[model samples]
Target chain A: MYRYLLHRILQIAITMFLLIAMVFILFRVMPGDPASMVLDPKMPPEAKALMKKQLGLDEPIYSQFIIYMKNLLHGDLGRSFYYGRPVYDVIMERLPNTILLFTSATIISWGLGYALGKRIAWRRGTRFEHALTFMGLLFYSVFLPWFGLIMIWIFSYRLGLFPLGGMITPELWTAGGAGIIALVLDVLHHLALPLFVLTLLSFAGAMLLMRSSMLETLREDYILTARAKGLSEKVVRDKHAARNALLPMVTALALSLSFSMSGGVLTETVFSWPGLGKEIVSATLNYDYPLAQAAFIFLAAIVLMANLVADIIYAYLDPRIRY
Target chain B: MSFFEIQGLRMHYATSRGRVKAIRGVDLKMDKGQALGLAGESGCGKTSLGLSILRLLPNNAHITRGRILFHGEDLLRKSEEEMRRIRWKYISMVFQSAMNALNPVYRVGDQIVEAILAHEDITKDEAKERVSELFSLVGLDPGRAGQYPHEYSGGMRQRAVIAMALACHPELLIADEPTTALDVIHQKQIIEKMDELREKLGMTMIYITHDIAIISETCDVMAVMYGGKIVESSKVRDLLRRPMHPYTQGLIRSIPPLHDSVGRLTSIEGEPPSLLSPPRGCSFNPRCAYSRDICRTSEPPLRQLNGGLVACHFAEEIPWP
Candidate 1:
């Protein structure tokens, strides 16, 4: 087990290294010059040169790579040009909010999707199952920003029930001595809209995959053996069919993270929720190279970690999937 | 009353083409402690017949008509909840592919223990003890019980599935091609082990297989299925010694004689008739060498011939030609 874990960890490390290298190359190859984007066109050529030299943009690409590697080793992610502060600090501040939003969104979507998918696979020909599949496809294929806006228009703007946008009531931040419960409740209330939108975006993928996977699993020979053992439908479905069905979905989780994280970007932006997704967006729009790079690295690390977790789960769920 | 009896059992599979009759008007009976072997070629409905006894047919395959009387009570009439209590407790089944029959993620012994716990009011510890006993009964080392199905070899896995079937000491054990996927040596061992278990436990069993040779070794009574019907049924030794039905004779001849003959092996001439739209009268008429005008025009009713039953118009004739 330890050897297997070591093998996986080594694999993850190599993946992360390659990812970092790839992103660095991508940022370099993009057409925009960071120094020019950061400065005004009216600036004199020598002043622009001085600014470029100061930012180390004039350094040889190899030397820049070395400096990037050195700073990375020291846990430095460079500085955000627009924020004029450490990229690490800026991301760290909003990291928890994105984690809070996307993590819950993902878990809820997949969990509900998995349950519904199980039923859909079992009652494959039923009208209700067909309706759910249509809904899942509809929700999954709908434009995210458009969907989020529509939800806001219905639930907040017109109904006047929810906060229209942002993380929390701006007035509440300065309200001193508000108990942690109220504070938490206030954050959740603010979180409600984005979470729902993100969750809605997240559902369709998991549901379709799980349904097809479970449908295949139901026909597996072991399932027949399970029934022959005289187990009830519930036990046969849960312990026999769903247990095996859950395996492919578990392996697919790593791959799905990229799409869902991208969804998180749109969901966060629409809600005006200050998270890494939103940070990554504005940073990219402003050509804040350091911030964008850091965000890329962070998201890349998350994907690698998810992949690693998926491997562990595969090992746990399937005895055949040996290290 | 017979220990178990199946009367007029018919299972029809609903396909896009049409309703394909898989098992039609099949009747069987087994006394307590008797081992009945169901033998046929592939797609001959032998497995379907065994599955029908437990009402485990697939969703598309419906049991159109049947009375599976277990100890004088009709099993088909039982509710799913009641069937749950009776299944694995009163009857259990072993499958064709032992590798696929056992869940890979679980320890072989734990699966047995779960089967026991599902049907019996026993603690985990008690169930584990029974598992150990079952392992030894099936000639497996008790220590190997902790290992997952993948860790065990194919033979060991078959033994594990058998151990699981015998866990609750069900009155009836239906082994559906339990040795088909094993090597020749394992096949013999599995057949012998099943026979020994039947004798030692005094449990009734329905041994379903395509191998006619293995039947006499493991079963007391043997029934031969053709297309969607049972064409012959009798004591295993008697049936093997003198198979009456033309289809049964073809099946016996299809296998090489053990005493060494220098002739090419004889196999039935045609494929199994499609159950969707079978022949006008007899399904096997196209395949039978002795099929006559009457045989093609009228379905032969199963009738007593000597001490056995044969469903052929010319069962009394000496020479098949």
Candidate 2:
């Protein structure tokens, strides 16, 4: 087991290196100059050249890559041109909010999808299954931004059950020791709309996948053997059928986890969620090459880390699967 | 009273195309220490009859008519809960493809123990001990029970399945082609083990298979099925020496001889009739070389002949080997 884990860790490291190199090259090849974005428009050509030299922008691409790699090895992620701060520091500040949103969305979708999927599969050829299937297809087919808007209008505008947008209410941030509690509650209240939108769109695929897997697993001869052994219906379904059925779902979850770091770009931007998706979009629009590069690297690291975690979980779930 | 009796059994599957008659009306009885072999081709409803005894047919399939009595109690009339209580304890089944029948994720020992624990109120340790005893009974090394199903060879897996079937000391065991996937040597070993176990436990058995040679060796009474109905039944030796039904005669002739001058083996001419819309009179008329006008105009009832039951309009008239 230790050897397998070590092998996986080494593979993840190599994958991260390749991802960084690819993003670095792609960012450089894009037709944009970070120095120009940062410099004063009124400055003379010689001053601009001096600023570019200071930023190491005048060096050849290979030399710049080597310097970047050396600094990255020493725990330097370069500086953000717009923020005028270390890229790591800016990312760290935004990391918690993204983690909070992504983690909650994942848990909610998985829990809801699995439970509902199993229920629908068990009660197959029923009204509830038909309704859930139709609703799922409709929700996922629509654009994410449109779904988010519809949810906000229904739940926030008409019902007034949740805050419109943003992390915390203005009043809660200044409310004393109770301020932390109020802030947490406010954030949760603000989170409801986006969470529901994301979950509604993403959960359908999980539900459909889990339902199909469960149906297939139920047909396996082992499950019939279990039943013939006089096991209770619940025990047969939960212990025998569900565990085997979840194997395919485990792989699906792994792939979903890796890609979920990019949230729904339009949804994040529409809600001003301040996640990596929003950061990358605005950086690209402003031609902030350094900020865009940092965001891409962070996103790549997240996806790679998710896949590594998934591999570990896969090994635990099924011993037959190993590195 | 017999250990179990299946009287007038019938099952049909409702498919999109039409109703498929899986098992036509049939009657079978097994005494406490008797072994019965149900022999037939693939679509002859032998497996369906076995499953109907346990009420384990798929959703589309139903026991349209039957009276399965176990220890004088009607199994078909019993509640699902009552049937559940009787399944592993009173009657157990060793399905075909033992390798796929056992759960792959569980250890072999744990699976056997689980079978025991499900029916009996025993502690885990007691269940483990019983599992080991069962392992030894089936000619497996008790210590190897800790291994997973994948770790065992094909023969060993079938032995494990037999061990599991015997876990609850069931009064009757149903084996559906238990050795169908094994080599000839392993098949002999399994058949011998089953015979020995049957003698030791004094348990009745209903062995379902298509191999006439195997049934002749292991079963005391044999029934031949075709197109969802039994065409012939008798003592194994009697059936082999004098098959009264034309279909049964053809089946017996189809078997290649151990030493023969015939260059090629005899075979039945055509496939079994479709159960959806079987022939108007005899389902085997199209395939029987000796079929006559009476055989094609009226269905034959199972009637007593010289020494066995034969379902043929001209049972006494057909020539036999």
Candidate 3:
């Protein structure tokens, strides 16, 4: 087990290094000059040159890469040109909001999907099962932004059940009189619409995957053995069938972190939730290369970690999995 | 009343093309402690009959009509809850393909313990003890109970499966091709083990296999199935010595002799009839060498022939070579 862990960790480290380099190169290849965005066109040529030199933009690509690597090793992600602050601080500030919104959404989606998928697969030919599968497919295929808007329209605008958008009631947050618990509750109230949208959309993927996987597991001979053991239908389905079916879902659940991260972009935009996804988009639009690169690296790191966790969890769940 | 009896049991599988009549009007009876061997080619419904006895047939397969009477009670009339209590506790099964019979993820011991705990009102510790005993009963090492199915060899897995079937001291054990996946040496060992267990426990057993040789080694009574019907049945010695049904004769001839000089081995011609639409008369008429005009027009009914049952119009007329 220790050897396996060492192997996986080494794999992750290599992947992380490659990801960091890729993020750095992708930002450089994009069609934009950082200096042009920061400096005015009316400025004198020499002033612009000085600013470029100071920013290290005038350095050769390889030297810039070396300096970038050096700074990265020291935990510096450079400064955000737009925020005029450390890119790390910018990401740290908004990271919790994204994690709060997407993490909760993902866990809830997977749990609900697994339960529904197990039920539908067992009761496969029934009308209820067909209807749920159909609805799952529909929810899965729907446009994310449009779905978010529809949820906001029905639950927030028309019914007045939740805030229309944004992460908080600005006036309430700035009022200074509310307690800490109230402030947290206030954020959650604003989170309701986007969370619902993200959960519903992602729920379909997990449910469909689980349903098909479970359908396959039900055909295994052990299921017949389990039934012959005089186990109740519930035990046969839940313990024997569903437990085996859950193997593939573990990988899907872990991989979903990356999916939800990309998904976070649209979800955050639609809901105005101030998460890393929103920060990444705005950083990219403003050509804040350091912030965008750092954000991509962070996302990549999380996805790689999730993949590693998936492998470990898979090995733990299935005894036959050697590594 | 017979210890166990199946009367006119007919089972069919619903498919897109049509219903596949997997079991058709099959009647069988056994006394307590008797070992009955069911021998047939693949898809002859031997496995289906075993599944029907346990009520373990898949969703698409339905037992259209039957009365499975165990100890004078009709098992077909029992509720699923009642069937659950009867399964494993009364009639357990050692499934085919031992390689896949056990769940891969669970520890082999735990799987057996689960079977014991399911039907018996035993604590987990008691169930584990029973699992250990069962492991040793099937000639497996009790210490290896914690290992997964993948860790065990194919023969060991079959033994583990047998241990599981015997976990609750079931009155009847149905072993379907239990040795099919094993090597010849393992197969012999398993057949010997099963025979020894049957004698030691004095438990009623139905060994389902295509190998008549295994039946001769382990069974007192042997029944030959064709398409979905029991075409011939008798004492294992009597059936092997003088197989009456043409299909049964062909099956016996197909088994190569141990010491006799090798000759051109005779194989039964043609595939087993498609159950979706069986031949008009005898299910084996298309494959029978002695098929006649009447044989193709009327299905032969199983009837007494000497001391045994044979289902062929020409059973008496066919000359023994």
| Model 3 interface DockQ | 0.90
- For model 1, residues A205-271, the per-residue Cα lDDT tens digits are 8988999999999888888878877788999898888888999998676656543453367777789
DockQ, 0 to 1 scale, candidate 2: 0.70
**Ten-residue region with minimum lDDT total, candidate 3 chain A:** A257-266
Cα displacement (angstroms), candidate 3, residue A260, comes to 2.5
Candidate 1: tens digits of C-alpha lDDT, residues B121-223: 8799998998899999999999999999889988998898989888888999998888889889998888888898889889999988888778877788999
Model 3, range A234-279, lDDT digits (tens) per residue?
A: 9999999999999999988998866566447888888888888888
Question: Candidates' interface RMSDs, in order?
Answer: 1.3, 1.1, 0.6
Q: Is candidate 1 or candidate 3 better by lDDT?
A: 3
The alpha-carbon RMSD values of the candidates against the true structure, listed in the order shown, are 2.1, 1.9, 1.5
Calculate DockQ per candidate and list them: 0.73, 0.70, 0.90
lDDT of 2 by residue, B106-223 (tens): 7899988888888899899999999889889999999998988888999999999999999999999999999999999999999999989999998999999989888888889999
Superposed on all Cα atoms, model 3 deviates from the true structure by an RMSD in Å of 1.5
Report the poorest 10 consecutive residues by lDDT, candidate 1 chain A: A254-263
Model 3 lDDT at residue B89: 93
